[model samples]
Target: MSIDWDRRHCSRKGHITYAPDEAGLRNRLHASTAVGTVWRCLRCGDFVLGEPHGSGPAELAPLVPRGRALRDLFILRFLAVERVLRGVLVVLAAWAVWKFSNSQDAVHQLFESDLTAFRPVADHFHYDLDHSPVIDSIQKVFDYKKSTLHAAAGLLLLYGLIEFVEGVGLWFAKRWAEYLAVVATAAFLPVEVYELTEKLSWFKIGTLALNILAVLYILIGKRLFGLRGGHAAFEAQCRGASLLEVEVAAGEAGGTQKEPLPVRQRSSTADPA
Candidate 1:
């Protein structure tokens, strides 16, 4: 019995394959195609080799081949390193929280000192100093001057929490994590730029540059041509089992020398099973 090469199946890892019986011809696939296979399927009438994986919209370029997928995966894994970096940031944030929590007197002092500096800007921005319940409560906590310091510290704590979440997601190669990190990095760019404008320093410049690079890498480098999806598919394609394999094995048991049919080129995209 001939296995219909028309049907598709998950080969080994996750690659979609056609004509699984002709395992010997697997390496004969063209190297330049998407997943590095040349076999075609009569069922789909689409080229199965080199098709992009996943259901997302088609990107600008074709699916990256298996070899290129390996390289891209390596580069992207570096972004996961941010987890270690966030560990250090988390420590700093905890310290800040502790210091602010204990030093109510210092908060009061700083608020008092910065009173005049903050008032003009606060007023110009139409932030009600009197009727605003939030600011009113802060004044009670740490006088007018230290109120802003308390608020700043609170903001930093929130940022720290967000960073922690982002770090965890990225480390696990979650898609949402990549999207969140890109957004957070972009949101920080304006603030970093504003800081540099106030007083251009080497440290500030370097910090801003790093943030920009991080955003770029996440949005463009990681998503547009990232390998996590494609690499997983290519590995699947390299697997040697399929319905065709079963038929070929049975034929051999019967001492039949039936020649495996030529692998057909599938016209439709290969679903990375």
Candidate 2:
């Protein structure tokens, strides 16, 4: 379904109204009615009743994210959530590995005794527990040196920390966070691909694909690394989305708000709804 990004944002954050000092801009933003004054919302471009939330020169107006900017924010936040989840899982895995390293001998003994007890059951079901790939895998972990286990845990913890930081940065839509995400995610692509080459799995492929997409989306969408006219172009695109900026630009171009800001006002005597 198509989403009304502007209205959806206004609904959550409340309407934002600004009174510009410029007469032409101010006239377009608000009007005096019999009941009260209604100012146009910069976020949704809807006339809102009551006083404007703020007043300033048109150039001093706040940059409010509407439309595509909101959508981009949503996408970045979604990636942020994914990064947080992965970070948590990785951290937990690191903890588990560290704990297992500490009690390696006890766990190994327990596994052997338990396997012995289950051997008869396995034979009854014609299952070969002795050479099972999964069993061998668990046994091989027992063979890892304590130092090796500790090193693995440390690496996992470091990775988890990176993911957590990246997630938090993206959640706030910081440009530096976007850069960090691109670099960190792209840096892991080779390792992920190598893992898939070693042991193919749908999960691995999906993760790799997601990482690649995230890198591309952030790198290109954000105009990073000087692509597509770089940061200047990006900032301009975002500025163009502002209702105030649009109107101010129009006025500067000798068109008086360029095109009239879309606004609906009740001409009736009924109090502003």
Candidate 3:
């Protein structure tokens, strides 16, 4: 009989009151099963004595081992967190641009009005107004056209949206998200490398390394761009040591059982007097 492996809970049997916890069930089954045998249901937590026929016992057919999936999920979550932080930064940048645009007139007025008074304080601090690149840049920003500020804010918002989308998609383990992340991250590598060439810093190096690692992990581990036999090979690997496959192999090696099979019981501890 064909089984819908996607549905984890046993609806007809009503084994569990709530929805079946696949992770919990997997741990229980892994601990219960013998070294060479596969006998527990990852879905419904039922013991499999023989091939499940007419709902006798739900077969164990995990798409991937829980341990490996957990690790992959953890990596995805880390990437998601990074993307989310980037999104927030870009959003804050957009807000900063908006605020600056609104307050530039006041700032310019204040700078012009206080130039005489500020120069004494600047002199006291040994600051050179003629050679301060930071002050020059601030003055240039304050003089920038309104259209340019709007365009900058728009671009920042767009980039923030993209980062937010990538974070949410990766969090859900979507294949499209993996592709988007890899492409977007790789696209920034050239710019990052150029920045590194301009100025060397540990922060820049670390950021570059992280992006490279993320790209590599998505391409190799997720089997993107037909690497390592692509998705088909990945799927096969996931199903290789599955419970259903093992049971089928065992049945093919031998004949069908006529009587009920013996259930392996764990040794119990004795109560002390």
Candidate 4:
């Protein structure tokens, strides 16, 4: 009987060989290209040597992690979505600013003509026109200088660009993206807090909480800023679960002479049970 190398069985159970998916590989080694022809079990971080040779077993090289990977995936996906959403919102804001600025003259003319026509009627009703908040707000919009509106539009566009870059980088799971997200999110904490102080809402509270969580997750989970021994510890942890080390353990257990076969040969051969 031959072992089913292509089967989707647990590596810890010894029934099948398993390997980490690309995300898992990157997470464990910090560099996927360094190790060749080895994979880690998603469940136990054990290594499985070689690739599935045929249809004899189901393709299971990308082992599904039973624990941490799920959480990590959720967080990464959430941050990516959130950043993208923010980017879109800022873009809309920029557009609105540009449109509003350009149309301000027309708006002012219309408002003045309408208000002049309505003033006699309003006076008949004894309405306090000068004290009306609505009227004051409309007047303020008309008073905005062109240069001020242009500056505002420029700032919004720049903010949108930053958000778009962050979203794209995070979506690709880049390490630098994680750092940028953490910093950018943390920087807004004070503003969010101040906004809450001015006015409280469920939406604002939820956003603040999520931002705080994102920052903590990147800092602690990622071992940033020397937390948990920082980059050195992070690299060590990755190496500990790496495929090369796992292969050595697998070799000892199976009592088989382990050697990396050429890619062509490995793809063509099936292991005997």
- TM-score versus the correct structure, for each prediction: 0.44, 0.88, 0.69, 0.64
Q: How far in Å is the alpha carbon of 220 misplaced in model 4?
A: 1.4
Number of the top-ranking candidate, with TM-score as the measure: 2
lDDT of each: 0.51, 0.84, 0.64, 0.63
Poorest stretch of ten by lDDT in candidate 3: 264-273
Q: In each prediction, how many residue pairs overlap at the backbone (N, C-alpha, C within less than 3 A)?
A: 20, 1, 0, 4
Angstrom error of the Cα, residue 256, model 1: value is 18
- Looking at model 4, residue 37 earns an lDDT score of 56
Candidate 4 residue runs with Cα over 4 Å from true position: 1-70, 113-129, 247-273
Query: Candidate 1: where is the Cα deviation over 4 Å?
Result: 1-66, 83-87, 106-151, 224-273
CA lDDT, candidate 4, residue 143: 88
lDDT of 2: 0.84
Q: Residue by residue across 149-192, what tens digits does model 1's lDDT show?
A: 55666776677777777776665555577688788878878888
Name the runs in model 2 displaced over 4 angstroms: 253-273
Q: Which of the numbered candidates is closest to the native, going by highest lDDT?
A: 2
Better candidate number, 1 or 2, judged by lDDT = 2
**Number of backbone clashes in candidate 4:** 4
